[model samples]
Target: MINQKSEVKVFPTNLMKQKETTTKLAIILPGAGYTSQGPLLHFSSGHYFKQEHDVLQVNYRFSEAELNPFDTDGFSANVLHTLEETLKETAYDQCFIVAKSIGTIALANLLKHPTFHNASAIWLTPLLHRDDVYQAMLQYENNSFCIIGDKDFCYREERFANLKSNPSLKTLLIPNGDHSLENKEDVLGSIDMLKNVIDGVIQFSN
Candidate 1:
Protein backbone atom coordinates (compact mmCIF):
# COMPACT_ATOMS: atom_id res chain seq x y z
CA MET A 1 0.00 0.00 0.00
CA ILE A 2 1.06 3.59 -0.64
CA ASN A 3 0.42 6.78 1.27
CA GLN A 4 -2.88 8.46 0.47
CA LYS A 5 -1.19 11.59 -0.80
CA SER A 6 1.17 9.72 -3.15
CA GLU A 7 -1.22 6.82 -3.82
CA VAL A 8 1.31 4.96 -5.91
CA LYS A 9 3.46 1.95 -5.01
CA VAL A 10 6.38 0.95 -7.19
CA PHE A 11 7.96 -2.49 -7.35
CA PRO A 12 11.01 -2.40 -9.52
CA THR A 13 12.51 -5.61 -10.89
CA ASN A 14 16.20 -6.39 -10.52
CA LEU A 15 16.44 -6.23 -14.29
CA MET A 16 16.06 -2.49 -13.94
CA LYS A 17 19.64 -2.45 -12.68
CA GLN A 18 20.81 -3.85 -16.01
CA LYS A 19 20.14 -0.47 -17.56
CA GLU A 20 18.14 -1.79 -20.51
CA THR A 21 17.03 0.90 -22.91
CA THR A 22 13.63 -0.67 -23.33
CA THR A 23 11.39 -0.91 -20.25
CA LYS A 24 8.14 -2.70 -19.58
CA LEU A 25 5.70 -1.32 -17.03
CA ALA A 26 2.79 -3.09 -15.38
CA ILE A 27 0.14 -0.90 -13.73
CA ILE A 28 -2.40 -2.21 -11.28
CA LEU A 29 -5.58 -0.21 -10.64
CA PRO A 30 -7.62 -1.48 -7.71
CA GLY A 31 -11.30 -1.17 -6.83
CA ALA A 32 -12.42 1.45 -4.29
CA GLY A 33 -12.38 -0.89 -1.30
CA TYR A 34 -9.97 -3.38 -2.77
CA THR A 35 -6.38 -2.27 -2.46
CA SER A 36 -3.47 -3.59 -4.50
CA GLN A 37 -2.77 -6.06 -1.71
CA GLY A 38 -6.01 -7.87 -2.46
CA PRO A 39 -5.55 -11.45 -3.59
CA LEU A 40 -6.00 -10.98 -7.34
CA LEU A 41 -4.01 -7.77 -7.68
CA HIS A 42 -1.29 -8.97 -5.31
CA PHE A 43 -0.65 -12.14 -7.27
CA SER A 44 -0.83 -10.35 -10.57
CA SER A 45 1.72 -7.81 -9.35
CA GLY A 46 4.07 -10.63 -8.36
CA HIS A 47 3.58 -12.26 -11.73
CA TYR A 48 4.54 -9.11 -13.56
CA PHE A 49 7.51 -8.55 -11.29
CA LYS A 50 8.84 -12.05 -11.92
CA GLN A 51 8.42 -11.47 -15.63
CA GLU A 52 10.87 -8.55 -15.28
CA HIS A 53 8.37 -5.78 -15.69
CA ASP A 54 8.44 -2.96 -13.16
CA VAL A 55 5.13 -2.77 -11.33
CA LEU A 56 3.19 0.34 -10.35
CA GLN A 57 0.23 -0.10 -8.05
CA VAL A 58 -2.18 2.79 -7.76
CA ASN A 59 -3.72 2.76 -4.30
CA TYR A 60 -6.46 5.33 -4.64
CA ARG A 61 -8.20 6.02 -1.35
CA PHE A 62 -11.85 6.92 -0.82
CA SER A 63 -14.07 7.96 2.05
CA GLU A 64 -17.43 6.30 2.75
CA ALA A 65 -19.20 9.12 0.94
CA GLU A 66 -17.00 8.74 -2.09
CA LEU A 67 -17.62 5.00 -2.24
CA ASN A 68 -21.37 5.43 -2.55
CA PRO A 69 -21.06 7.69 -5.55
CA PHE A 70 -18.31 5.69 -7.26
CA ASP A 71 -20.48 4.92 -10.26
CA THR A 72 -20.65 8.58 -11.20
CA ASP A 73 -18.55 10.12 -13.95
CA GLY A 74 -16.97 12.36 -11.33
CA PHE A 75 -15.38 9.31 -9.76
CA SER A 76 -13.98 8.21 -13.09
CA ALA A 77 -12.58 11.66 -13.73
CA ASN A 78 -10.88 11.66 -10.36
CA VAL A 79 -9.31 8.28 -11.03
CA LEU A 80 -8.07 9.37 -14.43
CA HIS A 81 -6.57 12.49 -12.98
CA THR A 82 -4.82 10.65 -10.18
CA LEU A 83 -3.39 8.09 -12.57
CA GLU A 84 -2.16 10.70 -15.03
CA GLU A 85 -0.50 12.70 -12.30
CA THR A 86 1.19 9.60 -10.86
CA LEU A 87 2.68 8.66 -14.22
CA LYS A 88 3.97 12.09 -15.06
CA GLU A 89 7.36 11.31 -13.55
CA THR A 90 7.56 7.71 -14.74
CA ALA A 91 8.60 6.50 -18.17
CA TYR A 92 8.39 3.15 -19.90
CA ASP A 93 8.65 1.83 -23.45
CA GLN A 94 5.73 -0.55 -23.09
CA CYS A 95 2.77 -0.63 -20.70
CA PHE A 96 0.28 -3.20 -19.44
CA ILE A 97 -2.67 -2.34 -17.20
CA VAL A 98 -4.62 -4.55 -14.83
CA ALA A 99 -7.75 -2.94 -13.40
CA LYS A 100 -10.62 -4.17 -11.24
CA SER A 101 -14.15 -2.83 -10.71
CA ILE A 102 -14.04 0.95 -10.39
CA GLY A 103 -10.46 0.80 -11.59
CA THR A 104 -11.82 -0.56 -14.86
CA ILE A 105 -13.67 2.72 -15.21
CA ALA A 106 -10.35 4.54 -15.00
CA LEU A 107 -8.79 2.18 -17.52
CA ALA A 108 -11.54 2.99 -19.97
CA ASN A 109 -10.73 6.67 -19.78
CA LEU A 110 -6.98 6.08 -19.92
CA LEU A 111 -7.36 4.12 -23.15
CA LYS A 112 -8.40 7.32 -24.85
CA HIS A 113 -5.12 9.05 -24.07
CA PRO A 114 -2.28 8.70 -26.58
CA THR A 115 0.17 7.42 -23.95
CA PHE A 116 -1.98 4.41 -23.13
CA HIS A 117 -3.84 3.91 -26.41
CA ASN A 118 -1.67 0.95 -27.38
CA ALA A 119 -1.30 -0.57 -23.93
CA SER A 120 -2.69 -4.02 -23.25
CA ALA A 121 -5.22 -4.40 -20.43
CA ILE A 122 -6.86 -6.87 -18.09
CA TRP A 123 -10.31 -6.03 -16.74
CA LEU A 124 -11.60 -7.83 -13.66
CA THR A 125 -15.15 -7.47 -12.42
CA PRO A 126 -15.71 -4.36 -14.50
CA LEU A 127 -18.75 -2.11 -14.10
CA LEU A 128 -20.62 -3.00 -17.23
CA HIS A 129 -23.76 -1.21 -16.01
CA ARG A 130 -22.20 2.05 -17.10
CA ASP A 131 -22.72 2.76 -20.80
CA ASP A 132 -19.40 4.58 -21.13
CA VAL A 133 -17.43 1.72 -19.62
CA TYR A 134 -19.17 -0.77 -21.86
CA GLN A 135 -18.65 1.40 -24.92
CA ALA A 136 -14.97 1.91 -24.15
CA MET A 137 -14.37 -1.81 -23.99
CA LEU A 138 -16.32 -2.33 -27.17
CA GLN A 139 -14.31 0.24 -29.13
CA TYR A 140 -10.86 -0.71 -27.85
CA GLU A 141 -8.75 -2.35 -30.58
CA ASN A 142 -5.75 -3.40 -28.52
CA ASN A 143 -5.09 -6.76 -26.94
CA SER A 144 -7.26 -6.98 -23.81
CA PHE A 145 -8.84 -9.53 -21.49
CA CYS A 146 -11.89 -9.33 -19.23
CA ILE A 147 -13.18 -11.63 -16.51
CA ILE A 148 -16.50 -11.34 -14.75
CA GLY A 149 -18.88 -13.51 -12.75
CA ASP A 150 -22.45 -14.26 -13.73
CA LYS A 151 -23.65 -13.31 -10.27
CA ASP A 152 -21.93 -9.94 -10.17
CA PHE A 153 -24.40 -7.06 -10.11
CA CYS A 154 -22.67 -5.46 -13.07
CA TYR A 155 -23.01 -8.57 -15.16
CA ARG A 156 -25.58 -8.49 -17.93
CA GLU A 157 -26.00 -11.37 -20.33
CA GLU A 158 -26.52 -9.02 -23.24
CA ARG A 159 -23.51 -6.89 -22.39
CA PHE A 160 -21.24 -9.89 -21.87
CA ALA A 161 -22.39 -11.26 -25.19
CA ASN A 162 -21.50 -8.03 -26.90
CA LEU A 163 -18.06 -7.89 -25.31
CA LYS A 164 -17.36 -11.52 -26.18
CA SER A 165 -18.01 -10.72 -29.80
CA ASN A 166 -15.14 -8.26 -30.04
CA PRO A 167 -12.20 -9.85 -31.85
CA SER A 168 -9.61 -8.02 -29.78
CA LEU A 169 -11.24 -8.95 -26.50
CA LYS A 170 -10.94 -12.21 -24.59
CA THR A 171 -13.33 -12.93 -21.73
CA LEU A 172 -13.92 -15.43 -18.92
CA LEU A 173 -17.34 -15.84 -17.40
CA ILE A 174 -17.34 -17.49 -13.97
CA PRO A 175 -20.41 -19.44 -13.01
CA ASN A 176 -22.06 -18.53 -9.69
CA GLY A 177 -19.25 -16.16 -8.76
CA ASP A 178 -20.09 -12.78 -7.28
CA HIS A 179 -18.53 -9.31 -7.46
CA SER A 180 -15.34 -10.47 -5.78
CA LEU A 181 -15.25 -13.53 -8.01
CA GLU A 182 -16.12 -15.68 -5.00
CA ASN A 183 -18.71 -18.44 -5.05
CA LYS A 184 -20.46 -18.49 -1.70
CA GLU A 185 -21.75 -22.02 -2.18
CA ASP A 186 -18.46 -23.50 -3.30
CA VAL A 187 -15.26 -22.42 -1.60
CA LEU A 188 -13.05 -24.81 -3.58
CA GLY A 189 -14.68 -23.80 -6.79
CA SER A 190 -13.86 -20.18 -6.08
CA ILE A 191 -10.25 -21.06 -5.47
CA ASP A 192 -10.09 -22.98 -8.74
CA MET A 193 -11.76 -20.13 -10.54
CA LEU A 194 -9.21 -17.71 -9.15
CA LYS A 195 -6.36 -19.87 -10.39
CA ASN A 196 -7.91 -19.99 -13.82
CA VAL A 197 -8.14 -16.21 -13.82
CA ILE A 198 -4.52 -15.85 -12.76
CA ASP A 199 -3.43 -18.28 -15.45
CA GLY A 200 -5.32 -16.35 -18.05
CA VAL A 201 -3.76 -13.07 -16.91
CA ILE A 202 -0.25 -14.53 -17.10
CA GLN A 203 -0.74 -15.99 -20.55
CA PHE A 204 -2.40 -12.88 -21.91
CA SER A 205 0.37 -10.70 -20.52
CA ASN A 206 3.02 -12.85 -22.20
Candidate 2:
Protein backbone atom coordinates (compact mmCIF):
# COMPACT_ATOMS: atom_id res chain seq x y z
CA MET A 1 0.00 0.00 0.00
CA ILE A 2 1.22 3.46 -0.88
CA ASN A 3 0.85 6.05 1.87
CA GLN A 4 0.92 9.78 1.36
CA LYS A 5 1.32 12.76 3.71
CA SER A 6 1.37 16.51 3.17
CA GLU A 7 3.29 19.26 4.93
CA VAL A 8 4.89 16.85 7.34
CA LYS A 9 7.71 19.21 8.45
CA VAL A 10 8.18 22.95 8.93
CA PHE A 11 11.68 23.96 10.00
CA PRO A 12 13.72 24.29 6.79
CA THR A 13 10.43 24.92 4.97
CA ASN A 14 9.11 21.92 3.00
CA LEU A 15 5.80 20.31 2.04
CA MET A 16 6.21 16.62 1.36
CA LYS A 17 4.52 13.24 1.33
CA GLN A 18 5.52 9.59 1.23
CA LYS A 19 4.49 6.57 -0.77
CA GLU A 20 5.01 2.84 -0.06
CA THR A 21 6.81 1.54 3.04
CA THR A 22 8.66 4.23 4.97
CA THR A 23 11.72 2.03 5.47
CA LYS A 24 13.81 3.55 2.69
CA LEU A 25 13.83 7.31 2.21
CA ALA A 26 14.84 9.37 -0.80
CA ILE A 27 14.95 13.15 -0.63
CA ILE A 28 14.03 14.89 -3.87
CA LEU A 29 15.08 18.44 -4.74
CA PRO A 30 13.44 20.20 -7.65
CA GLY A 31 14.84 22.77 -10.07
CA ALA A 32 15.24 26.43 -9.21
CA GLY A 33 12.29 28.83 -9.39
CA TYR A 34 10.02 25.95 -8.48
CA THR A 35 8.35 25.05 -5.21
CA SER A 36 8.69 21.57 -3.73
CA GLN A 37 5.14 20.89 -4.81
CA GLY A 38 5.96 21.32 -8.47
CA PRO A 39 8.33 18.36 -8.88
CA LEU A 40 6.53 16.21 -6.32
CA LEU A 41 3.31 16.65 -8.25
CA HIS A 42 4.85 16.55 -11.70
CA PHE A 43 8.07 14.63 -12.36
CA SER A 44 7.73 12.25 -9.44
CA SER A 45 4.63 10.77 -11.16
CA GLY A 46 3.44 9.22 -7.86
CA HIS A 47 4.72 5.73 -8.79
CA TYR A 48 8.35 6.34 -9.78
CA PHE A 49 9.85 4.47 -6.86
CA LYS A 50 6.89 4.10 -4.54
CA GLN A 51 7.00 0.33 -4.70
CA GLU A 52 10.43 0.20 -3.08
CA HIS A 53 11.10 3.50 -1.32
CA ASP A 54 9.50 6.47 0.37
CA VAL A 55 10.09 9.92 -1.16
CA LEU A 56 10.37 13.29 0.52
CA GLN A 57 10.22 16.46 -1.55
CA VAL A 58 11.62 19.69 -0.18
CA ASN A 59 11.51 23.38 -1.09
CA TYR A 60 14.13 26.05 -0.52
CA ARG A 61 13.46 28.86 1.92
CA PHE A 62 12.87 31.40 -0.80
CA SER A 63 10.39 29.13 -2.49
CA GLU A 64 8.52 28.40 0.72
CA ALA A 65 8.34 32.04 1.88
CA GLU A 66 8.92 35.46 0.32
CA LEU A 67 12.18 36.27 2.07
CA ASN A 68 14.20 36.33 -1.11
CA PRO A 69 17.96 36.59 -0.57
CA PHE A 70 18.25 37.32 -4.33
CA ASP A 71 21.59 35.57 -4.64
CA THR A 72 22.21 32.13 -6.10
CA ASP A 73 25.08 31.28 -3.78
CA GLY A 74 23.09 32.21 -0.67
CA PHE A 75 20.11 30.23 -1.89
CA SER A 76 22.29 27.20 -2.55
CA ALA A 77 23.84 27.46 0.89
CA ASN A 78 20.41 27.68 2.50
CA VAL A 79 19.19 24.65 0.64
CA LEU A 80 22.27 22.60 1.53
CA HIS A 81 21.98 23.62 5.17
CA THR A 82 18.34 22.64 5.22
CA LEU A 83 19.16 19.24 3.70
CA GLU A 84 21.81 18.60 6.31
CA GLU A 85 19.44 19.57 9.13
CA THR A 86 16.62 17.45 7.71
CA LEU A 87 18.87 14.41 7.41
CA LYS A 88 19.71 14.74 11.09
CA GLU A 89 16.02 14.63 11.97
CA THR A 90 15.15 11.63 9.80
CA ALA A 91 15.90 8.02 10.62
CA TYR A 92 16.87 5.95 7.60
CA ASP A 93 19.41 3.23 7.10
CA GLN A 94 20.54 4.75 3.84
CA CYS A 95 19.91 8.15 2.25
CA PHE A 96 19.63 8.97 -1.45
CA ILE A 97 19.38 12.40 -2.96
CA VAL A 98 17.62 13.00 -6.30
CA ALA A 99 18.03 16.49 -7.69
CA LYS A 100 17.07 18.11 -10.97
CA SER A 101 18.56 21.01 -12.94
CA ILE A 102 19.64 23.86 -10.68
CA GLY A 103 18.77 21.69 -7.72
CA THR A 104 21.48 19.34 -8.95
CA ILE A 105 23.94 22.19 -8.69
CA ALA A 106 22.99 22.57 -5.06
CA LEU A 107 23.49 18.87 -4.57
CA ALA A 108 26.90 19.08 -6.21
CA ASN A 109 27.91 21.81 -3.81
CA LEU A 110 26.61 19.77 -0.93
CA LEU A 111 28.67 16.82 -2.17
CA LYS A 112 31.78 18.86 -1.42
CA HIS A 113 30.85 18.83 2.26
CA PRO A 114 32.10 15.99 4.42
CA THR A 115 28.63 15.61 5.95
CA PHE A 116 27.22 13.95 2.81
CA HIS A 117 30.14 11.61 2.36
CA ASN A 118 28.03 8.51 2.79
CA ALA A 119 24.83 9.46 1.01
CA SER A 120 24.12 8.29 -2.55
CA ALA A 121 23.02 10.86 -5.12
CA ILE A 122 21.38 11.02 -8.53
CA TRP A 123 21.64 14.13 -10.68
CA LEU A 124 19.08 15.00 -13.35
CA THR A 125 20.39 17.49 -15.88
CA PRO A 126 22.97 18.84 -13.47
CA LEU A 127 24.12 22.33 -14.46
CA LEU A 128 27.51 23.03 -12.94
CA HIS A 129 30.99 23.68 -14.28
CA ARG A 130 32.81 21.92 -11.49
CA ASP A 131 33.85 18.52 -12.72
CA ASP A 132 35.79 18.11 -9.49
CA VAL A 133 32.58 17.88 -7.52
CA TYR A 134 31.49 14.92 -9.59
CA GLN A 135 34.88 13.36 -9.19
CA ALA A 136 34.71 13.87 -5.43
CA MET A 137 31.29 12.25 -5.32
CA LEU A 138 32.67 9.27 -7.22
CA GLN A 139 35.37 8.92 -4.61
CA TYR A 140 32.87 9.12 -1.76
CA GLU A 141 31.50 6.05 -0.05
CA ASN A 142 28.23 6.30 -1.96
CA ASN A 143 27.29 5.69 -5.58
CA SER A 144 26.20 8.50 -7.87
CA PHE A 145 24.27 8.54 -11.14
CA CYS A 146 23.88 11.33 -13.62
CA ILE A 147 20.81 11.23 -15.90
CA ILE A 148 20.42 13.49 -18.89
CA GLY A 149 18.23 13.69 -21.94
CA ASP A 150 20.00 13.42 -25.26
CA LYS A 151 18.28 16.53 -26.53
CA ASP A 152 18.80 18.50 -23.36
CA PHE A 153 20.27 21.90 -24.07
CA CYS A 154 22.61 21.55 -21.12
CA TYR A 155 23.73 18.12 -22.18
CA ARG A 156 27.39 18.58 -22.90
CA GLU A 157 28.03 15.33 -24.73
CA GLU A 158 31.78 15.50 -24.41
CA ARG A 159 31.71 16.20 -20.70
CA PHE A 160 29.15 13.51 -20.04
CA ALA A 161 31.10 11.09 -22.17
CA ASN A 162 34.16 11.86 -20.12
CA LEU A 163 32.26 11.32 -16.89
CA LYS A 164 30.94 8.00 -18.14
CA SER A 165 34.43 6.90 -19.02
CA ASN A 166 35.13 6.90 -15.32
CA PRO A 167 34.15 3.46 -14.03
CA SER A 168 32.99 4.98 -10.75
CA LEU A 169 30.37 7.29 -12.27
CA LYS A 170 27.17 6.06 -13.89
CA THR A 171 25.48 8.04 -16.63
CA LEU A 172 22.17 7.48 -18.40
CA LEU A 173 21.02 9.34 -21.48
CA ILE A 174 17.40 9.21 -22.52
CA PRO A 175 16.87 9.09 -26.25
CA ASN A 176 15.11 11.95 -28.00
CA GLY A 177 14.29 13.49 -24.66
CA ASP A 178 14.66 17.00 -23.36
CA HIS A 179 15.80 18.21 -19.99
CA SER A 180 12.40 17.30 -18.52
CA LEU A 181 12.03 14.12 -20.54
CA GLU A 182 9.06 15.80 -22.18
CA ASN A 183 9.17 13.66 -25.31
CA LYS A 184 8.59 10.54 -23.31
CA GLU A 185 4.88 10.73 -22.58
CA ASP A 186 4.93 7.12 -21.56
CA VAL A 187 4.97 7.31 -17.79
CA LEU A 188 5.81 3.63 -17.73
CA GLY A 189 9.14 4.36 -19.38
CA SER A 190 9.98 6.93 -16.77
CA ILE A 191 8.98 4.54 -14.04
CA ASP A 192 11.14 1.81 -15.51
CA MET A 193 14.20 4.02 -15.68
CA LEU A 194 13.67 5.23 -12.14
CA LYS A 195 13.21 1.70 -10.90
CA ASN A 196 16.41 0.55 -12.54
CA VAL A 197 18.35 3.43 -11.04
CA ILE A 198 16.91 2.88 -7.59
CA ASP A 199 17.57 -0.82 -7.81
CA GLY A 200 21.14 -0.16 -8.82
CA VAL A 201 21.55 2.13 -5.81
CA ILE A 202 20.15 -0.51 -3.52
CA GLN A 203 22.55 -3.04 -4.95
CA PHE A 204 25.54 -0.74 -4.59
CA SER A 205 24.56 0.57 -1.15
CA ASN A 206 24.60 -2.95 0.17
Worst 10 residues of 2 by lDDT: 1-10
What does candidate 1's lDDT look like per residue over 128-206, in tens digits? 9988889989989999999999999999899999997789999999888899888989989989888988998999987
lDDT of 2 at 206: 49
Judging by TM-score against the true structure, name the best candidate: 1
State the C-alpha lDDT per candidate: 0.80, 0.59
Candidate 2, 1-206: lDDT as tens digits: 10132222333444243543355666777775544555323444244354455566766433423433334455456666666666566666666777777677667767667766566787766663556445544454457777777777877777777775556567777676566644567777766655554454445434
Q: How close is candidate 2 to the true structure, as a TM-score?
A: 0.65
> How many clashes in each candidate?
0, 0
Q: What lDDT is obtained when candidate 1 is compared to the true structure?
A: 0.80
Model 2, residue pairs in steric clash: none
Q: Candidate 1, 132: how far from true, in Å?
A: 0.7
